[model samples]
Target: MGLLFGSFLNVVIARVPAGESIVHPRSRCPRCGHQLAWYENIPVLSWLALRARCSSCGLPISWRYPLIELLTALLFLACQRRFGWTPELVAALVLVLLLVPLSFIDLEHWILPHELTWPGIAAGVVLSWPMGWGRVQDAIIGAVVGFLVFWGMEWLGEKIFKKEALGAGDKDLLALIGAFLTWKPLLAVIFLSSLQGAVVGSLLLLVRGRAGPAPDPEPGPESTPAPPVGPEPVDTGGEEKKAEDEEEEEDDWEPGPTSIPFGPWLSLAALEVMLLGPLLREVLPVPLDMLFAGAR
Candidate 1:
């Protein structure tokens, strides 16, 4: 079941950002436009069977396909082990579903769509009902507080620092996390996300000289030009801001070489708190363990 859902998630990751329907067109080779048959879409086995090439056009398939399938399966197993057969298991699984795609989408596009985050926030609160009103209340507070925390940070960055520090979508994503895990562990979530992101980002900066993907360089005069289209789609960084209103504000910011996406780091921290909080608390020193005192 995890593998099957993971397969569908690949479709979500590919189509959602492009503003395309996930179900309308069958899966196709992005490189060649060859439609994939049912057999060709059979998760990890099919990838191995086809030797990681499209059967029709022989375009090399991305390893992400199998990796996501395996990752989902393993995480599902971990959730089952941690939560047993309790109602919380369902919540954990749902959180996993939302996080997996959001993480990948952010890594590739650096935008967590409101489409996913909004629905996920509602789902988190709804799922908590099975555990009673206390859980539901926590979920609600978590969502609001999560959004406010990031929004405050964003406000500070813009007003005091004179730069946009966080992606607009990040508040929504953090709210989605808060809704699922409740407000208690939010500090730990922020701490872990920031610490891990900083460490990894610094390493990436050292190794690649850039912490995140840079925009494609502008075309040169010698570059072959395409026939002029009326207007090309401008990437709005996943925010649904009005183009005319945001034009000037958008021009004020560009992703610097050291910029990195925070959504994946947030997702990773949430997962750790969800599945391994107790172990982590025990493993860390007493001083550090204080951070996870309220962890579930």
Candidate 2:
């Protein structure tokens, strides 16, 4: 089930960003538009059998396919071992399904589409109904608090620093996580995510000279015929100078060296709190254990 779901998630990760229908169009090779057969789409097994290349155009398939499949299988197995056959286990499975694609999508595109986060938030609330009304209330409060916290930070950052400190979709992702985990562990989630994101982001900046994955370069402007050569025009009333200054200001607003996506860190923290918090609390020192003790 995990392998199958992982295969489907690959579709979600690929299509959601492009505003494409994950269902209507069948999986096809991007290079040759070759529609895959049922046998060709059998998760990791198919990838291995095909030698990680498109049969039609011989385009090399990304290794991420099998990695995601295996990661999902292992995570599902871990959830089973932790929660057993219960409603909580079912909830865990759904959370994993949502988080896996969300994390990868943010890592790749640095955007979390509402198509996933909004539905995920609702699903988390609805799924908690079986646990109890108190849990449902907690989930609701958690979602509200989670969104407001980030929103506040965003507002403050813009007011003080005159720049965007958080991505537009980060609050929604955190709210979705809160809807699943409830309010009690939100502090721990924030702490763990910040700590881990800082460490990894610093390393990436040192190695790659940027904290986040670089965005794809947009195509340059189309070539045009050159105008007749003439003497350079003089600035008239300083208008051209003002225009150049404004352009420079706009360029200054672009992302800097330490701009990393926060969504992946948030997702990772949520998964850690859900799956490993208890074990961590048990093994760590008393002071440190308290940080991980707030799991739902």
Candidate 3:
């Protein structure tokens, strides 16, 4: 079931950013426009069978497809073992479904679509009903508090640094997480995510010479060649100038330094708190245990 869902998630990850419908037109090869046969859509097995290439076009398929399927399967098994047969297990599974796609999408695009986060906030509150009224109340408070906390930080950062510090969607993501986990664990989530993101982002900066992707270099005047001098010049109707302008407009733009996406790190920290908070609290010192104990 997890593998199947993961397969569907691949479609969501690919299409959502482009504003394409995930269900419409069916899956087809981008290069050859060949509709995938039933056998060709069998999760990881199909990719292995086809040798990671489209049957019609022979275009090499990305390895991320099989990897996502396997990763989802493993997470599903882990949730089953941790929560057993309970409402919490169902919530955990739903979270896994949401987080996997969101994390990958953020990593690729550095943006978290509100289409996922808004519905996720609602779902988290609704899911808490099974636990109790108290849990539902906590969910509501968590959502509000989570949003306000991040909003305050963003405001302060903008005032202090005179630039945008956090992505606009990050607060929504944190609120969704808080709606599921509640306010008490939010501090821990923030702490863990910040610590991990800082460490990993620093390492990436060291290795790649940038925290995030490098910005596209602006085209210079030197790139355009001067028109040849001749007694008689053929009339090209300014096609060359138009082409150069189009190419310049199509160049990709990237964010400045220290601009890593925080969504993935937040998702990872939330998952860790859900799955391993209890164990961590048990093993850690008394002072540190209090931080992780709220989630458990």
Q: What TM-scores do the predictions have?
A: 0.88, 0.87, 0.85
lDDT of 2 by residue, 108-198 (tens): 8767899999999999999999999999999999899999999998898667755566777889988998999998888889999888888
Backbone clash numbers for all candidates listed = 0, 0, 0
- The candidate 3 region of ten consecutive residues with least summed lDDT is 226-235
lDDT per residue as tens, model 1, 1-296 = 78998998999898998889989799999988888888989989999999999888888999999999889989999999999999999999999999999999888876798888999999999999999999999999999999999999989877875556788889999999999999988999999998888787767756765566553234233543221110112222343323233222453334444567889999999999999999989999999898888787
Q: Model 1: runs farther than 4 Å from truth?
A: 216-253
Evaluate model 3: give its lDDT.
Answer: 0.79
Cα-based lDDT at residue 200, candidate 1: 76
Candidates 2 and 3 compared by lDDT, better number: 2
Following a full C-alpha superposition, what root-mean-square deviation does model 2 have from the true structure? 8.6
Ranking, lDDT, top scorer first? 1, 2, 3
Report the candidate with higher TM-score, 2 versus 3: 2
lDDT by candidate, in order shown: 0.83, 0.80, 0.79
What is the Å distance of residue 265 in model 2 from its true position?
0.9
User: What value does the lDDT take at residue 144 in candidate 3?
Assistant: 94
Candidate 1 positional error at 170, Å: 0.6
> Could you give candidate 3's per-residue lDDT for residues 1-296 as a string of tens digits?
88998998899888887789989988988899999999999999999999999999899999999999998988888889889999988888888888888888887777789888999999999998998999999999999999999999889866764445577788999999999888888988998988888777667756764455443234343333322211111233343332222121112323435457788889999998888888878887998788986886
